[model samples]
Target: MIEFVLNGRPQKLDQVDPNLSILEWLRTKMRLTGTKEGCASGDCGACTVIIGTPDQSGKFQHEAVNSCISLIGSLHGKQLITIEAFRQEPGHPVQQTMMEQHGAQCGFCTPGIVMSLVALHASGQPDASSERAILEALSGNLCRCTGYRPIVAAGREALVQAWSPDDETHPAACLVQEKRALEATLSTGVGLSLPDGPRYDAPQTLDELRKLRGRFPEARLIAGGTDLALEITQQLKTLEHMISVERIPELSGCRVEGDELVIGAATTYRRFHRPISDRWPAFDGMLSRLGSLQIRNRGTVGGNIGNASPIGDMPPPLIALGATLVLDGPDGERRLPLEAFFLGYRKTDLQPGEFIHSVRVPMAQPGQRLFIYKVSKRLDDDISAVLGAFQLTLDGNEVVACRLAFGGMAATPARALAAETALCGQPWTEASVARAIAALASDFQPLSDVRASAGYRLQVAGNLLRRALLASDPRHNDEPMLVTDYA
Candidate 1:
């Protein structure tokens, strides 16, 4: 049986569909219709909910996630707080301000918006009230009638007068105690299996995961289920058997090992953000635009790489950084470069019964410079049309070494070998940049797709190279170069 705390009460389920989503269970089975579903594909935030997991101190750390795409089986040993939880003796501060500021009209999106704000307020982060922070927090939520002006105002005010779980009598405190008890009762490697339906297995240790993978070679491996869930929700594909690697301690978290940043394969993007941005400051804007805050809370870097989509955003940057992966299987572990992992469109080099264990990124040297750019239709919560990542190390004004990688420009996220060769040993100037831009024609012949035409993709790729050159030039030292700088 799977156990969790729902609305400060313990909930246990022994027989449930493994492919069921949290949103479906809440609105259908539990008859809690407060959480509405607008875009079942996880684009619209009408199904937003707060997931609270106990931190080291036994206090809950809350994060907003999309209930529509998150599997119900993934909620084991955690607290699921839906919109119904806010209907207490005293309403939440966000609800009060939202009412006072007229932040709802038609009220279809209000529940999700309020839940997002509640998670932000409950976080107690110092910058949660800032204008940029508030806007980012609500990026996933779409309000057609009420507009964002009043909703933003409500968020700002609510943050100033927000209430936190401070004492023992608080409802959150009781939920925390209940969560601790539930976690203690959960056995390691707890999973859900239905005789007539699908099967979900969660392994807690590396050995357990390896053994499961060897036993069930046909089972799909899942982490955050951000991408895999779409098959079930959108395409109506039934994943009969699945193994979850998120609970494996050896496959989660990040650490600095000597001169490299070693990150577990199951580490969520939200957890890897700080460490990566700290090492390569150019990644801050691109990483934030990878998806909305809700997606990042549940999406993992390993999943992004494993998907092997030609236009996947993370691979381009990671390839330019010369990152490597550690894959674990029945025969033990093997290491491979990130670029070599992809063989073709939607194809990877992963063997049967093998899974990505971790990723290692080398630290930048003193004179090394990195530039990353994402070109998309929308600035936020959109897929990339072209993502360019360039890394260069110069000896004075001459380029000693360089790596140029582009996505959405080829069958796979591959390096522009022809362009990199043109830039190597050349002076860092507009003239040399033009040569590299010309070489791009030889490097890639991107295909036309719904996101962009082939000509547009090629043009954007060249322009991005020029932008990188300008960013590294001394003449443009005072100019704002990065997307985050303008924001």
Candidate 2:
């Protein structure tokens, strides 16, 4: 049976459709209509909900996630909170501010917005009141009828208010006890079999996961389910047998091992933010723009790499950083460069029984300059039209070594060996940058898509390289090169 806490109450289910999403279960089974579904594909955040999971300190850490694309099976040992949890009588801060600031009109998207703000408040982050922080928190929720002005105002007001989590009556406080109980049950491991011939298994250790993989070779491996869930929600495909790697201790966190950052395959982007930003400061802005806060909270780096999409945002930067992947299977473990994992469009080198174990990124060295630029249609929660990641190691003015990787410029996220060779021994100047720009034409011949034309993709790719060169040069230190730095 699958167990979880819903609205401060413990819930257990012995039979359920493994393909059912949290949104679907809420509205269909529980008849909780407060969580509305807009775009079932997770683009629109009308189905946003808060999920509370225990952190290392045994305190509940709340995060907002897109419910429509989140499978019900994934809520095994966590707290699933919906908009119905808040009451109108004892009004919550988010609801009160929404009414005081006139944040709702037609009220179709108010619940999701309120849930997002609630998550922001529950985080207790020091910068929750800042306009940028509030905007980042609400980036996933879209208000079509009422503009964002009043909603942003409500967010600003609600965040500044004092919230006491210690209150015995508060949901957060109540969930603490319930979460502990739920975790205790989860310690035995979870294996659910539905009447409809679908099974979901969550293994706690690497040995259990390896055995499960061997036993069910055709079973799909899931971690975070940000991309995998789309098979059910968007394409209407049901996953019969699934093995979850998220619960495995060996595949759920990151650590610094010597000169490399060793990140587990199931590590979510939210967990990866600090370590990646600490190592490469330039990645902060680009990583935030990769997806909405909701997506980042649930999306895993390994899933992004394994998906093998030509325009996947993380691959270009990871490739440029010279990252390596560790894969495990019946034959034991093997290591290979990240770039070599992608075989073709939507294809990877993973064998039938092999799975990505972890990724190792080398630490940045002195005199190494790195630039990551993502050109997308929208500033937030959008796919890239062209993402350019450049890393250069310079000996004085001349470039000793460099790596230029671009996504959305080819069939796979690949390096521009031709362009890198052009700047290997050249001076790090406008002249050398121009030469590399010219060589990029020979490196890639992109296709025309709805996001951008092939010519525009090529043009932007070169311009991004030039922007990196200008931003890296000491002569242009005072100039604003990044979009966030402009204002």
Candidate 3:
């Protein structure tokens, strides 16, 4: 049985298909059809919903998530709020402000927009007035009919003026309290056994997960399912036997150990963003635009590396930052440099049954400067065409040392050794920058894929290094270059 709190009610599902999507379950089984299915594959923002879960402090936190591709099994122990609940409630700030701002045109994406706004408002972060904050909050939601101006206005209004004195008595809040009372209702103490002969195991400890992996080496291991679930929705594949390590308490925590950050493999970007970005400000900026709030809410940095996508944004920065990955299996734990984890296209150094347990990153030391550039067709919530990460240390006017890594340039996210060699020990000047840029040709022979051409990738890699050099120049505090504004 799958149990969760749905709009102040304890909802349970018996004999449910383990592969059924959350969107399908909500629209078909529950007969609550307010959530639209604009895109079946997690894009288009038509199927966004709010998920409330207990934070580390045991406080309930609301997050907007894409339900179209999210599996029903993923919502097993959380509070789910839909547009229907908001509609029934009298003058919820999101609904009232959306109406006052005239934020709905065709009304197809309005529910998702309102729900995403509600999540942002409920996040305890101050109502976002900044354009970037609003954009980051609504990045997952797309409205073709209602231009973003009104939607952003509504979001501001919801934050600024939408709350009522009676809101404490609202259904959602009552549901929160109810969910707290029913916290032990989750059947997590035992491994889940489906009636259809498929099983989904949720392990709460590293030893339990290790034993499970040792037992079922063939079982598909899942953390966030942000990428693995795509195999089901896009390629039409069924993950029969699965082990989910998301519930493991240790694997979902991040901490500062000495000068390095030890982040659990299952730690979401949202949880590690502040500590990580605090160490690397440029990295922080790239993360804000990495994906929509929904994607960031669940997407894990360790998962991104484990997925081994050449175009993933996280790997490039991790590689450039001299990060290491910890992999554990029946053979016990082994550590490897981040770059060595990727061997070829879609291939990794991970042995059978070995899964990534955690990632360790050395914090930025003094005189060390970092720059990350993500070149995507869209400014936010899009895949990267060319991503670059550079970590440099300068000695007066000389380039004492540097590390340059580029994604979407080769079969794997590899460092530009030739470029790094050319820049090291050279004077930090335009001449040295030009030489380093020229050496980029020898570093990579990129492919002409849909995202970018070989020549385009080569050129962008060099251009990104040039921008890094310019941005690192402390002689002037000039603004960094914007790829969108490039003529």
**Top-scoring candidate (lDDT):** 1
Rank all candidate structures by their lDDT, best first, as comma-separated numbers: 1, 2, 3
TM-score for all predictions? 0.96, 0.96, 0.95
Q: Tens-digit lDDT track for model 2 on 304-323?
A: 98889999988888899899
Residues 166-260 of candidate 1 have per-residue lDDT tens digits of: 56444334334533576574457778878878899988888999999999988999999989999999999989998999888888999999999
Regions of model 2 farther than 4 Å from truth = 170-178, 475-487
In candidate 3 the C-alpha lDDT for residue 162 amounts to 33
Span of 10 residues, lowest total lDDT, candidate 2: 478-487
| Segments of candidate 1 deviating more than 4 angstroms | 162-164, 167-179, 475-487
* Clashing pairs in model 2, backbone N/Cα/C closer than 3 A: none
Every candidate's lDDT: 0.87, 0.86, 0.80
